[model samples]
Target: MVMLGDILAAARGSAGALERWLAHADPQLAQDTACAAKSVGLGIAGYARMAVADFSRFANEEDWATLVSSLRDSSDPGSTCLAAMVHWRLSAVGCRAHSIPQEAGAKDE
Candidate 1:
């Protein structure tokens, strides 16, 4: 069985690496984690989509912690599953910034 460390390592390497792990992992394990990730991802996506409509709501406190509490409190691979879920959610919502931050004195193009 894939350990939490394995999942975290893959996630740290790249989202693709995690995807590959999911793809090649045991069907039950992959399906369980993926399903959990998808549920969390879509919930987060709802919040993000809402925040896009109302920036103020961006700061809204959600019970997101509870959402992943199960994954976190689970046995081995629990945190790893949470990590993957978070990654998937962020990617799904385009939360990863591809551009570098500009310096204080940087001129705008």
Candidate 2:
């Protein structure tokens, strides 16, 4: 069975590769991978948000902003919520950044 980690890794990698390909004007691969990235990013962000929601101590405005920025920068889809949650957590903690690693093993996904 494929683990969530595996899925996220694949999505992130695909998104990165697609971005690079698009930069080079590789239309075929870029188009295909871009679509895939959006799906994967959304899945990952949603999972993360749901998993961390109850942990109010870690959700704040700064965290949300950072998360939103990351999500916007991400090639994934529907990541805006994830970003908002991050900001909320950070604001709650009165910190500009979270102790958690934003890049945590997952690359793009």
Candidate 3:
């Protein structure tokens, strides 16, 4: 099981490595890698937003779409839903800062 922070860190690191690899790749691979990196960064930022009670009030459909797109590409619906639920819960709490216990268990990456 991986905590959100750990997952975000791994994603960020992978994105960095992928970006470097993209610099020497074919056009298609470069595009794919860039997209992956962007997705990972988005996920990390989304998690941070949730942590800071900023994600719920930040109702940008475009951002949601971006997240959904990334989730689809990554084939990780559970992670997507977890991220979405984090924002949803924040919204439920009126975006107030509070401590929420981890539900069920840590997500597998």
Q: Considering every candidate listed, which one attains the maximal TM-score?
A: 1
Q: Can you write out model 2's per-residue Cα lDDT over 1-109, one digit (the tens) per residue?
A: 3333443454455645324423354454344433433444543333333334533454447555666576656564233333344334322433323333233353432
- Relative to the true structure, candidate 2 reaches a TM of 0.25
Candidate 3 CA-lDDT value: 0.44
Off by over 4 Å in 2: 1-50, 55-58, 78-109
TM-score of every prediction relative to native: 0.30, 0.25, 0.26
Q: How well is each residue in 1-109 modelled by candidate 3, as lDDT tens digits?
A: 4334554554456745323433443345444333433444443334433433445455468756765676666654544444554444433332223423232342433
Error of 2 at 88 (Å): 11
- Top-down lDDT ranking: 3, 1, 2
In model 2, the worst 10-residue window by lDDT is 89-98
Error of 3 at 90 (Å): 18
Q: In order, what lDDT does every prediction score?
A: 0.42, 0.41, 0.44
Kindly report the root-mean-square deviation of model 2 from the true structure over all alpha carbons: 12.8
